[model samples]
Target: MSSGGFHVHGPHDHAVEHAAQGHGHGDDHAASHGSEGGGSSMSKIAMFTAIVATVGAIFAYMGGATQANAGLLKNDAAIKKTEASNQWNYFQSKSTKQSLAELARDLAPEDRKAAYQAKVDRYESEKNEIKVAAEKLEADSHKFDRQSEEQMHQHHRWAQATTALQVAIALAAIALLTKKKWLEYGMYGVAGIGIAVGALATLHI
Candidate 1:
């Protein structure tokens, strides 16, 4: 014991020191546990984000495939339409030539065999005309087929672009889960570029 409102203890005061040490150790342990929990939460967030991004990428690929198939179908339809038109034109031209030949033969009767022979020659000439027209139309149809194939190819490119956009968007969303502002920002930039590409591709379609 001491004067001036101060007290001094012997060996028992060591108990106070011991209690303080235990409290401090408890506090440190609690703090460590909390820190570990926070780290685990962050890891979970990263894992979730990754899963979402992967799933989105898969869906985007599927969508791209479907869109490409649709474009191919459209091209096929266009080609068929053009082919049908050409066939109709060829039939009409052939019929017209045959009808004209019959009319010319009916107009003459005195020299019947000579007239018939002339009609045969005219029919042969008309056949040549039909053949030439059919050949030209065939060539035109082939050209159209090539154009349709090109169009389909353009559509496939568009699909790939859109798919990339979808994957980028998903990855951006995942970045947000980490609460890393910089990562999120980078993802946003990637997503924007993907969207621009998709838009350009769609325009071509």
Candidate 2:
């Protein structure tokens, strides 16, 4: 029937084709593995970005609080210094007036006595004014100190909060990188502790 012995694709050839098709499924599995690897990389980057932002926010808050606290402290010191200066001025003026009155009393004639009395009256008036000014200064200084102290306490709280936030962000980042469930929960727990501390401090203040 055939001109010579020759090979032809028949049922056996079809079986070989089926084997090739089954082997090709490996390529699909490999592609799926590649896709999963890419997804992992993307997820890692997202986690990193979130962690960095949280930490950055904490640092920013800390910086602001530091500046506020320093300014308040400086203000308190300045007010105290000014109050001291006012007190010194008042004391000096009173002492000078007293010395002058004593001198006038010691060396006075009848006509000069009237003039000396007038001088004493003027000095007394000036002394009263000085006393009033000193009292006002003292009051203002105390007010300034109280306000500054409050501001300092507020800033301190802000700093503490920022520090706590930073710690939480760092822990979260580590947990995500490591894919550890315990670490993730631990981060939240630590953050809660910080909040409690802040609350207590606020209550005390």
Best by lDDT: 2
For each candidate in turn, the TM-score is: 0.45, 0.62
lDDT per residue as tens, model 2, 54-99: 6547545754765576577668767766876777687788769877
* lDDT for position 159 in model 1: 52
Error of 2 at 188 (Å): 1.5
Per-candidate Cα lDDT values, in order, are 0.63, 0.69
For every candidate structure, what is the RMSD over all alpha carbons to the true structure, in angstroms?
A: 8.7, 6.5
lDDT of 1 at 127: 66
Deviation in Å, model 2, residue 203 alpha carbon: 8.1
lDDT of 1 by residue, 2-86 (tens): 7798987767788988999999999999999989976775665456556546654654564566556666655665665566567
Question: Each candidate: how many clashes?
Answer: 0, 0
Task: Please identify model 2 stretches exceeding 4 Å from their true place.
Answer: 1-59, 62-66, 69-73, 76-80, 83-87, 194-205
